[model samples]
Target chain A: MINLKHTKMKNELIKPQGLVKNANRRQFLRMGTMTVAGAGLLLIGCNNDDDMVPAMPGMVSLGTGDIGILNYAYALEQLEAAFYAEVIKGSYFANASAEEKTIMGDLEKHERAHREFFKAALGTNAIGALEVDFSSIDFSSRTSVLGAAKTFEDLGVAAYNGAGQFLESADLLLIAGKIVSVEARHAAAIRDLINPGSADFAGDDIIDSNGLERTLNFTQVLTAASTYVKTEIDFSQLPS
Target chain B: MNLIKLLDTICPDTKSAEDRDRFYSRRDAFRQFGDFGKKVALAAVPLSILNSIPHVAKADTASLIGVLNYALTLEHLEYRYYQMGLDSGVIEAPDRVIFQKIRDHELAHVRFLQEVIGNVLNGTPVAEPGFDFTAGGNFTPFSDYPTFLALSQAFEDTGVRAYKGQAANVKESDVVLTAALSIHSVEARHASMVRRLRTKKGLDTVKGWITNGSIGSLPAATTAIYAGEENLSHGGVNVANLTGIDAAAVSEGWDEPLDMNQVLGIASLFLAN
Candidate 1:
C-alpha cells in the first residue's frame, strides 16, 4: 500500500481552501488516539486514489454522525447547484416569459450560493464535487425546467427538515433551519410558475392532512436525487 | 399562561380525550416542580440569547414546555388570522381556496403542537385572547383584500422566524426538533405564496424570500415581524466573502429567526383588547 502520509500531504496542498482551512488527515494518528471516538468524525479522503483511500468505495456512506449529515447535505446542494447552472446555459423556450427567465437566474444564483456555503463550511471534510447527470431534464422547455426545479426544491426542503434530527450541534442545526426555508420558498415559487395560481403554491399533494411538507430519509432522498446525479450515494452507514 | 385554557379557547371545540389527558399529566409533571411549572410557559429563553447559557435539555421538561407553548401561541395567532379572513366573506372569489388551505395548516399546526408539548392544556391555558389584525382603528384587513394579504404576509413571515428561533431550544429532543423544522419550512412556503399573490396583483415587488429590508410597509404595529430579517451572516461565515454577494442578496439567502419575546410582541398587537 502507498504511504498514507505522503498521499494525504499531497492532496492537502491541492485542495487548500481560501477559507475554512481544516484537514485532519495529516494528524490522523495523533488525533485519532487522543480524541474521543467520533467526536469530530469528519475523516475524509479520496476512495480510489491508489495511494490511500480514507473512506470506503463502491458506495459512499454519508458516514454516521453530524459530519456525515453535513456531508450528506453538501452532496444535495451540489446536485441542485449543478442543475440550476445547467438550466441557465440554454436559451429560453418561446413560452418562457422574461419574468420566468429572471426567476430562473435568481434561483441559479441562490442554489450556487447555497452550494458554496456548504462546501466552505465543511472544509476538507467535504466531498469532492460529484459528477451530475441532468440529462433527463430538458432545459429549453418551460414545463420541464419548472417541474425539475419543483422536485429539487421540495426535496431539498424535506431532506433538511428530516435531517435536522440527526444534527448534534445546534449551530449546524441553525444553519440547516435557515437554509430549509430558502428551499421552501423556492419550492413555492417553482410551483407557482408551473401552475400560476395561489392554490398551487401550497398544493395538497405535497402537504399532508396536518399541513406538513413531505419528508424523506437520506436513502429515499438519495434515491430520487441520484437519478439526476452520476455519483453512487449509499446511506447504509448512516445511524438511526 | 395556562396552556390548556389557551388551547381550549383557540380550539374551544377541541374534544380530544387524548389531548385532555396529555395536558393533565404534563400539568401533573409540572406540579412535580411546584411553582416553576407555572413560570415555564412564560420563561422560554430565545435561541439567540441562549448561546451564553448552558443547555439542560435532558433534565428540563419545564424549558421544553416553555418552548412548545411559545410555538403554540404563534400558531394561535395565525389560525385566528385565517379563520377570521375566511369567515369575513371578503376573500377574493378566486383566493378563498388558498386562504382556506393556509388556515387548515395553521389549525393542524396548533393541534400538532398541543400534542407534541404533551397534548395538554393547563390554567385555562391562557384564553384565546381577542385578535384585531387592524389594531383597533387601523385599516380593516379582513374587509379589504390588499390589507388582508399584507397581514397574512406578516403573520406567515413571523411564523417562519418564530419557528426557527426555537430550534436551539428543542435540539435536545430529536422528535420535537424534526417536527418543528417541518412546520417551519411550511410556514416559509406560505410566506412565499402570499408574497407571490401580492406580486401577481401588483400589490408589491418582493421575492419569494425577504430581500434587504424590502418587506413592504404594512401597519406600523406589524413592523417588528420583519425586523432583523435583513441579516446576512450564517453561523460564523459572512456572505460578504463571496463574490457578488451583498447584504441584499445575502438577506434573501438565509431567513433570520426572531426570539420568543419578539414574536409575542407582534402577536400581542392582533390580540383583542
Candidate 2:
C-alpha cells in the first residue's frame, strides 16, 4: 500500500550497483592497500571533475516514503541556491542600497551553504542540477526583484510548515527544523524590508482558525514547480 | 451442476470416507480429500466476480509530511503570484525591494522542502506544474498596486490559516513540527505586512490580529469582496472548510490547523487548469 516497490526503484537508482554487496570486502581491501605508492598514484589520478561532477540525475526523487519528503526539501534548496548565486553574480538592481546589497549577499551565501549541506548528506543520491526560468523577472528593477523575493521567502516558510510532518528520521527532521527556522527568519526579515512593522508577516493565509497548518502532496507541489523548471520530474513514485 | 452444489455433493462423500476409515488407513485418503477440498473451494469462487471489484487506491499518510507538501504547494503559488506581480510592471519601486526579499524567501522555502523530501525519501520527486493563481482571469486582476496589495493580503492571510490548520499532522515529529511552527510564524509575519500595506493605502483590510467577531464567519462588509470570486477556488476545490477554524484564536499565540479541504481549495486559486 505504501508503494514499497516504487521506493525500491528509487533506492536502486540512487545507490551504485553492487555497492551494498561489496562494501565490506572493498573496505577491507582498501585499508590493506593504502600504501605510500597507492596514495601517490591516487593523488596523481584525482581530477577536479570527481569533486565537481554533478550528482547523478534523479537522485533527488523522493519515492513515496518519508525519505521522499526530505528529497523534496533538498531539491528546493538546489533551486534557491542557484537563484541566489545568479542574483549575487549579477546585482540587477542598480539602486540597491549598500545595506540591502550586504543582506542579500549574506542570504545568498547562506542558501549556498544550505544547498551544499544537503548535497553532501545526499552524496551520489542527490538530485541532478535543476534549471530555473526566471525570464519573467526584471532583475534590473528593485521592485520586480523584491516582489519575487517576498514570494520566495513567504512560500519557503509555508512549504516547510506544510511538509514537516512527513519526516520519519528524527535526526533528519532535526536538521530540517534547524534549516527551516532560519528560512523563517529570512522570511520575516524580507517581510519587514518590504514594509516596516510587518515582522509578523504570516496571517490567515498560511494558518487556519483552528491554529493548524496545511499539508500538501507531491502532486500539488509539482504542479506549481512545473512553470519555472525545464526538466521533467517524475513523481509517479509518490503516494497518490 | 453449479459449483456450489458439486462441492456440496462431493463434500459429504469425502467426509463419510474420512470418518469411516481407521486412523492409519485414512491418512492417504485424508490427504487426497484435503487436496480435493482445496480444489472445490477454489472452483466455487467466481473469477469474473473477483475481477469486477474495483481496486481501491491506498490512502497516503496524512501526517506531518502530507501537511508539509500542502504548505509547499501554497508557497509555490505565492511565489508565482508575487513573481507575476513584479514582472507585470504593476508594483512601485519602493515595493519592489519588499517583494524581492519575499520572493527570495519563498524560493528558500521551496528549496527547504525539496531538501526535506530528498532527505526523507533520499531522492527528489518531480515538481508539479499547471498552477494558475489568477484563476482563469476571474478574480480582481493584480494589474495595479492597490489590487496587487489587496490580492497579496488575501494570499498571505490564506497562507497563515492554512499553516495553522495542519499543525497537528507534524506534532509526532518534534523537530519537523517545531520547524513548521517557526515557519508558520513567518507566514503570519508576511500576512501582517501585507495587511498593513493595504491599510496604509486606504484599503479597509482586516487588522493583523483577528478579533472575536472575526471568528467563524466572514465580516458582513467583506462578504461581497470574495463572493463569486473565481480566484478563491483551487482546482475545483472549495474554501468552505476554512471557516471551521476559530478565527478569534488566530490572534492568539498558538498556531491553528487549517482544514485540509479548505487549504486545497485555496491552493486551487493558483492551480493551473
Candidate 3:
C-alpha cells in the first residue's frame, strides 16, 4: 500500500520554524472577553502585561466565516502596501538603478491596488487601517528593503494558500487565487533582485521538493506577520 | 483540524476478497514501473480507501478526479515542451539550470496528478498527448532561443490562468484545493522569471507582470495566453477607480482566469492531435 503522507506536504514547510518563535512573542488571547465597541466593530480587551497574556489592547476582530478571511487578507495587504510605499520613499530607491526603481514603483502600485480592492469588497465590514512598524528595517540599504519585500511577498503567497481551506465561498477562494499568484510573481521578482539571475527566486526554502509552494495556516500566517504589524488583530473569530 | 483530508476513512468490509486481490495484483504491476509507480503506490493506499466511502456521494470524488485530470493534461504539455527543449540543446549554459528547474516542476505535477487519478481516485490518468512546439510551423522554438523563451512564458502564464479557473471547482476538497493553489503560485513564479528574462534579453516592452495584456515580442498566436489579463474590475470594484493606482497597476494587480474552453483553444494549437 502507498504511504498516504507523501501526498501531504512536509510539515515544516506548512508550519515553518519561525512559527514557534512567533508564538512565543505574540500569544493568542482567548475569546469571550471580546466586546463590540460599536456597530460592525469588534474589540478585544487589553492585557494586564502579565507573562501569560501579551499586551493586546483594543485588538480588532476579523469576524467569522468568509468575511473574516477577507479581513485577514485585507490586513496583510495593508502591511505590504505600507512597506512598499515606504520603500519607494527611502534613499535606497532614490539612489537605485533604473530597473530597480521601476520594479519598486510597480510593486508599490500593485500592493496599493490589492489593499484597496479588499477595502472596497469588504466596504463597511472592512477592518480599520492597520498601523505597520518598519522600524526594524533599514530603508536606505538595498539588502534590508529587498529582504523585507521578499518576506512579505512570500508570506502573502503562503497565507493565501493555507487560508483557502477555511473559506466557505468559492467566489472568495477564486479571488484569493487571483491575488496569490500576483504575490508569488512579486516574491520571485524581489528574490531575483536580491540575488540577480539565481535559482534562489524559487529556492527550496519556499517551494517544496514536489514543486509546490509553502502553505501556512491562519495562526501561523498571523504569527509571522505580527513581527511587522503594530496593530493587535484579534484573529480569534477567524477560522483555524 | 483535518487540514489534509484526502478521504478520512474506508468503510470496513466494503471491498470483496476478489477486489482486494485485484488491488494487490495491481500493486505488483506498479512495482515494475520503477520510481514513478513507487511514488504513486504510496499515495494509492489512502485513495483506494476513498473509493469505498459509504456516505460520501460518488459525484464529489468523481468531480475532484475530473479536475485533477484536467490539470494533469496541462502539466504533461509543459513537461514535454521543456524536456524536448533541453534535449535539443537550444538553451544556453547560463539559462539551462532555470529551464531544468521548471521542467522538473512540470514533471512533478504530471506525476502527482497521475498518482491521485490513476491510483488513489481509481480513475484512468490521461495519456500524454503529442505536441508540436512549432505550433503548425508558425515558429521554430528549438532552433531559435527567442521563440523557445516566448513559448515558455506563454505556457507558464497559461498554467497560472488555467489553475485559477479551476480553483472554484476543487474548493470542495481542501486537500486538493490547497495543492492546486500551491501549484498555481509556482506557475506565477515561473511566469515572472521568464518574463523578466525576456526583458533583460531586450524585450523591453515586457515586465514580470503582464502590461495591459500585451504579449510583447511574442508572436500573435500567443495572444490568448494574455487575453482578459487586463481586467480592471474584480468582484464588482473597478480597481482603476482606487486612489493612487493607475489603470496599468489595476490590470497587473490581479490576474484574470481563462475558462476551460479558452485554455483548450490555446492548448490545441500546440497539441498535435
Candidate 4:
C-alpha cells in the first residue's frame, strides 16, 4: 500500500503540464507551417513529433522516478557540452593564445564525455537534444567568455555537491562522485585562469570549519536553472 | 492518544498491530505515559516553548535527502542572482562574463540534481518555487552592483558551509559523500572569487570568510561566533563573529559551518517581503 501511494504520488508529480495554452497555440501554428514545408521530408524519412527535436522552451521531461532525475542531468550536460563546443568553435575570444585554446578544448571534451556518458546510461529514455539560444553572450572577448566559464564550472561543482545527498543507489552515487570531482577540478582550473593567486579554492567557506560540504534542495536548483534553460522544467514529483 | 494509536498514525503500514503493541509493552507503562504526556503538552505549547524542545527533527536516512535539497536550493539562488546581474546591464564587460559563467554552472548543477533524483533515487525532481531575492529590503537593493556582490558573497559563503554541514549525512554512502565534498570545494572557490572581486572594488571583503585576530585585537562578535567554527559555517559568514582560516592545515582550510537553523534564517533573506 505504501509503495502504491508512492507510485501514485510520483505519477501525479511527473505528469507533464499540458503545453501552456499560449505555448500550445504557438506550437500549433509552428507545426502547421513545418508540416507544409517538410511534407516531402516527412514522406522520405522523418516520422513525426517523436523524431522532431523538442522546440525551444519545452520542458525536458525526466519522466517519473529516479530515471527522470538522471535524464535531467543528461539533458543539462547536453546543454553545457553544446555551449562550450560553440564557444571553442567560434574561437570567440580575442587574442586567444595556444595554451588557453588547449584548455578550452579539454573542457569541451570533458563536457562532451559527460553528455555522452549520460546518454549511454539512459539509453532510450535520454532526453531529445535541445536548441540553445546564446544571444546574450559576447564571445569575442577573452574576459567575457572565461568569466562565464568560471561561473559555469563553479555552479556545476556546487550542484553536484548539493545533489549528492539525495542519491539512493550506491553505484549511481559512485558515478556521480567521480564526475563531480572532475567538475571541481574544472572549477578550480577556471578560477585560477580568471584570477592568479586566488585558487584557495577549498577552504572553510565551502567545507565549513567542521570539514563538511554544503547541500541544497531540487526546487531551489531548478528555479535558478529556469532562466538559462529557456525550457520550463517541472520537478513537482521529486521527494520533498 | 495512546502510544499504540500514535505509532499507528505515524507509520500506518506496520506488519502487525500485535507486534507494535508488544514493542511498546517492553517499556514501563508509567514512564512511557509521562513521556507521551510531555510530548502531547509540548505539541500544544506556543512559540515560547519552541526553544526548549528545539523542534530538532531526529536524524534519519531522509536527512541525506534533506541535505541534498538544501544544497540544490542554494544553487538555485546563485543561478538567479547571476542571471539578474547579467541582465541588469550594470555589470561591466569582464564582470558580465563572470556572471554568465556562474549562470551556466548553476544550470548544470540543477540538471545534475534533476538526473540524480530521477535515476538514482527513483524520485521525480521537485518543482521550482518562486524565490524573492530581495528579502523585504532588509539590506541594500540588488540593483546596485556593490549590493549584489555583498549578497553574492553571503550566498557563496553559505553554500560552502551548507555542503560541509551536510557531509556527514552522506558518509554512509561513500560515493555520494565524496561527490558532495568535491562540490563543496568548488563552492569555496566561487566564494573566494566573489570576495576578491569585492575587495578589488574597495568593498569590505574581509567581512566575508576571513577575520583579523591577534594578541592586540579581539575578534568581532561575528568573528567570535565563527572562530574555530569555520568547519561549520555556511552561506553568510557571521560577519560580526568572524575567524580566519589557516593556509596550512587541510582540514582547517575551510571556514566553520553554521547551524542549520542559522542557514535557514539566512536563506529567509532571499524570501519576498
DockQ of each model against the real complex? 0.37, 0.05, 0.43, 0.05
**Interface RMSD to the true structure, each candidate:** 4.5, 18.1, 3.6, 17.4
Q: Which docking class does model 3 fall in?
A: acceptable
Highest-scoring model, lDDT: 3
Query: lDDT, candidate 2, residue B233?
Result: 19
- Please list the residue runs of candidate 1 whose C-alpha ends up more than 4 Å from where it truly belongs after superposition: A1-61, A93-95, B1-59, B118-126
lDDT of 1 by residue, A1-240 (tens): 112111111123123241122234323533444322332222222222221113434334354466668878888988888888888887553356777776777777777777777777666555667878778888887778888999999999989988887777787788888889988998989998887766778788877655667677765677678677765553433546
Predicted candidate 3, C-alpha RMSD: 7.9
Sorted by lDDT (best first), the order is 3, 1, 4, 2
User: How many residue pairs collide in each prediction?
Assistant: 14, 147, 3, 78
Segments in model 2 whose C-alpha atoms lie over 4 Å from true places: A1-60, A91-94, A210-215, B1-273
Q: Give every collision pair in model 3.
A: A2-B41, A2-B42, A3-B42
- Mark the regions of model 4 whose C-alpha exceeds 4 Å error after superposition: A1-57, A199-213, B1-273
> TM-score (chain B) for model 2?
0.61
Which scores higher on TM-score, 1 or 4? 1
Model 2 lDDT tens row, A1-240: 222222212124233443444345434544554312111111122222211212224323443344345457766676666666666656564468764675566566556555555554544444567667777667776666766676665556556655665555444544454455446545555655665643234433553322333444454455555555555444434433
lDDT (Cα, tens digit) per residue for candidate 3, span A74-117: 99999999999999999999999999999999989988888888
